[model samples]
Target: MAVASLIPPAPATGEPQSGCYMAATSDCGGRLSREHYISRGLIDGPELRVRGMPWQREEVARFSPDNLVARILCRRHNSAMSPLDAHAIRFFLSVEAGLKHAQRRSLSRKSRFYMTSGDGLELWAMKTLASLYSSGIEFMTPEHRFRDFEPPMERIVAELSSPNPCSIMTLSLPLMQDAHEEQIGRRAVSIGPIVDDETGELSGLLVRMHGIALVFNIDLPDKDALPETEIARPDMIDLIGMDRTSRIFLSRAKRRPEAWIVQIRLSHPRKDPPAGRSDRGCNRQPLRK
Candidate 1:
């Protein structure tokens, strides 16, 4: 379940102030345009009054564009990945905002209850799936964050890197265990017969994109009722990977404020998109840190 907002809060006066562009020069060696830090879509009509503050408060230092280091990316580069960048930026903004406004007590209870479940394996699966949806992953860029790869590129790498041979198997096993413990008051095995230590190591499996780690864990099933294999299976990979879906659900969640995006885009002209394609596409990515 996702919180209402995605973008985080604004920076306090003392926090480090920097632009998203890594190189702020406007030389002819080619220039890069800064993307908006926050998407206008995420902003409420009245929010135009809050200048310079892209996020709410409570956002981590890393997610702030003031602290982000932008790099020069060409037009060809930008167009090829525009959809993902736009979506990611939006997603980042929404998530941060939600965290800042979320009921602190409710969040604490959810964390505590989930933590007590002895099913480390399930926890691992949840973290993996969650990473893909995490705000950090949505706000990433190739030149500045990923360097050689785009945000989704890294997600692909991370998922493929899981040590477990079967992605579905890797995700399902733990989920069954977690659902059992959470829903049914059954105490799962910790070491011997109750738990499968071998599966515990799978928890370490992660899909890291940009600077954030996308992790997942499974929910245990009811002991008397074993897990339903169909739901736990990875049947939605194809749909989730689509450009449109990623942009809507994943990207919008991490968008930065318009001011921030403008600052980053214009910081370096060398990073501008190619001659022909300037604005197009509607895909998105996850953005949170």
Candidate 2:
């Protein structure tokens, strides 16, 4: 494949519908601001690398965290939603910290532990989806691209501004890998639209990078029989709460990984593991025969 240098965002579209793309009833009184398309604070590094974008065209693009921003949110709305970014950062960092601790300690290569809130992380993914569409950028890849991506803008605004934002969303771990079965860049994150295959419409969004991968299913009426993901997974991420800032634990391990497999299998439907069993994986895969 080829590597491309990221060009800057096209000049503003000069459209009348400016100000804040994320505002609904709440007024957009605050100054218009550039929202980091990929939340900057979540980078945890001086720079970030992005891949699989329309402009990059199957090429990897490097960016200083600040350079990857888009002017989409107002000061007030942006500030109000700052918590969303924090939540994503927490979830991502927890995964990072857990892995680091395990590596430093020379613990089992299979697993490590960490904590985060599911609801907030979901919102962050939604917010990221909003950013991607609102910026008017589309995936140029034929299969993954959305040329007529009609985003659910109203739902996005309502969910983001709501005091307890929770709407159509499902979380999953995508085992991101190349044809070579090698992990994509794990040091950074990428946000993109998920288009429905049959309808060719925008479905939801995928927020993934490094060891931390999450999918937000926004378009489906219900998360049933989600298409199998050809991505990577962390060993185990057990989410207990959906709408509140509850502490969730993710004790991950390197499972029997293969290229393009959605490794986080929804496990033991509602039933706990056998009492004495040491496993506590909410996202555990069923044992293979």
lDDT of candidate 1 over 33-77, digit per residue (tens):
433323223333332222112242432122333322233332322
Best by lDDT: 2
lDDT for model 2 comes to: 0.54
Query: Candidate 2: where are CA atoms >4 Å away?
Result: 1-17, 104-112, 174-181, 227-289
Q: Per-residue lDDT of 119-212 in model 2, one digit per residue for the tens?
A: 5666667777777778777665556656477677788777665544664565666433322113422565666667778877776676666534
Q: What are the clash counts of all predictions, listed in order?
A: 109, 10
The parts of candidate 1 lying over 4 Å away from their true place are 1-67, 70-72, 97-213, 216-289
Candidate 2: clashing pairs of residues: 110-253, 174-231, 174-232, 175-231, 175-232, 176-231, 176-232, 186-210, 230-260, 235-253
lDDT of 1 at 17: 19
TM-score of model number 2: 0.69
Weakest ten-residue segment in model 2 by summed lDDT: 1-10
Candidate 1: global Cα-lDDT? 0.24
The number of the candidate with the highest TM-score is: 2
What shift in Å separates residue 51 of candidate 1 from its native position after superposition?
25
Candidate 2 Cα RMSD (Å): 11.0
Query: Per-prediction TM-score, please?
Result: 0.23, 0.69
Model 1 TM: 0.23
